[model samples]
Target: MNRILMLLFMCMPVMLWAQRLPVHEKQKELQERMVEVSLSEIQERLSLTEMQISQLRPVYKQYQKKVARLNMQNHKLFNRMNADTLSDEQAKTILREYLDRERKLYALNKQYMDNLLEILSPQQVIKLYQSDSDIKRKIRMEYLRRTGKPKR
Candidate 1:
C-alpha cells in the first residue's frame, strides 16, 4: 500500500504537467492563427507585393513578441493589485510598474509604425491601423453574438 502511494506521489507532477501541455499547445496554435489572419488582412488591404510581404512578416512578428511580453508583464502586475492584503506602498509600486509598461508599449507602437512606414506608404500604414480596429470590432461583435449578450 505504501509503495503504491509512493508511486502515485511520484507520478502526480508528471500527470499534472502532461495535462497542461495541450492547453499550452492550443494557446500557441491560436496565437499563430491570429497572426496569420492579421497578416492576410494586411496583405489584402495594402495589396502588398510578395517582396513586401516577406519584409513585413519579420518586423510584424518581432513587434508582436515585444508587445506580448509587455502585456504579460502588465497582466502579472494587474493580478497583484487584486491581492486582499496589498498595502498602499505595494499598490503604488504596481502602479508605477504598470505605467512603465504603458510607456514601453507606447514607444513600441511608435517603433512598429516607423518600421511599417519603411515598407509601406503612409496611406497604407493608416489603412493597416484601420484594419486592426475593424478586426477587433468584428471579433468583439462575434463574441457578443455567441454569448447572446448585448453590447455594453
Candidate 2:
C-alpha cells in the first residue's frame, strides 16, 4: 500500500502533463518559444541593447524558419529511405537534393552572419551562437533529468 501510494504520487504530475500534450501540439509555437528563450539568453549574455534586439528580431526569425523547414525536409528524405530496396539512381537523387539544401543553408547562414555584423560586435555574434547551443543543451539535459532517461 505504501509503495502504491508512492508510485501514484510520483506519477500524478507526469500524467497531468501528458494530458496537456495535445493542447501543446503547436510545434510552431514551441519552436518560437525555444527561439525566444534562446534569444533572451543570448541578449543577456551579450548585453544587447533594445535597438540591437529590434534589428536582430526579424532576421533571426527568418533564419529560424528557414532552418526548421530545411530540417523537416531533410527528415522527410530520411523517412523515405529504405536501404534494402533503394536503387543507385534513387540514392544519387537523394544525395543531390541533400547537398543542394546544404548549400542553401550555408548561404542563408552567411546572410545571417552579414546581418548580425550590422548590429553586433563580431565577439557578440560569436557569443550569440554559443548561447544558442548552451540553451539547447540545458533544455535537453533538463528533459532527460525529469524523465529519468539516459543520454542518447
Candidate 3:
C-alpha cells in the first residue's frame, strides 16, 4: 500500500500532462478540419477540371504556408516593437520587408486567380470568390467560438 501511494504521487504530474495531451490533439484536429473544409468549399464552388484542380491544390497550399509564415513573423515583430527593445530603424526595416512580401504575395494570388479564371468562366470565378469569403467568415466564427470570445 505504501509503495502504491508513492508511485501514484510520483505519477501525478505525468497524469496531468496526459490529460492536456488530448486537448492539444483536439485543437490540432480542429485546425486541420477547418483547412480541409475550406479547401473543399473552394473546390466545390470552382468546379475545377481535374487538371486545374491538380494545379491549384498545390498553389493554394503554398499560399497558405506563406501566409502562416508571414503571420508568425508579423506577430513576432509586433511583440518586439511593443516591448520597446527594437530600434525604430529595425522596426521600419521589418515593416518594409513585410509590406514588400505582402505585395508580392498579392501579385502571386492575382496571377493564380488569373490562371484559375483561364480555366473557368467569369461566373464561376465570381462564385469561387464568394465561396472563399464565406469560408473565411466561417473559419473566423469557429475561431471565435473556440476562444470563448466574440470577434471585435
Show model 3 residue runs off by greater than 4 Å.
1-32, 46-52, 83-85
- Give per-residue lDDT, candidate 1, residue 13: 100
lDDT of 2 at 56: 85
Pairs clashing within candidate 2: none
TM-score of each: 0.81, 0.79, 0.65
Give the top-scoring candidate (lDDT): 2
Model 1 regions more than 4 Å off = 1-14, 80-84, 143-152
- How many clashes in each structure? 0, 0, 0
Candidate 2 TM-score to native: 0.79
Order the numbered candidates by TM-score, best leading.
Answer: 1, 2, 3
TM-score-wise, the better of 1 and 2 is: 1
| lDDT tens digits by residue: candidate 3, 34-70 | 6667777787777766776676666666666676666
Candidate 3, residue 130: CA error in Å? 1.6
Model 1: per-residue lDDT, tens digit, 1-152? 99999999999999999999999999889777777888888898889999999999999888987988899998877765565688989878888988989999999999999999999999988988898779768877987999999999
Question: Cα deviation in Å at residue 31, candidate 1?
Answer: 0.9
In candidate 3 the C-alpha lDDT for residue 12 amounts to 100
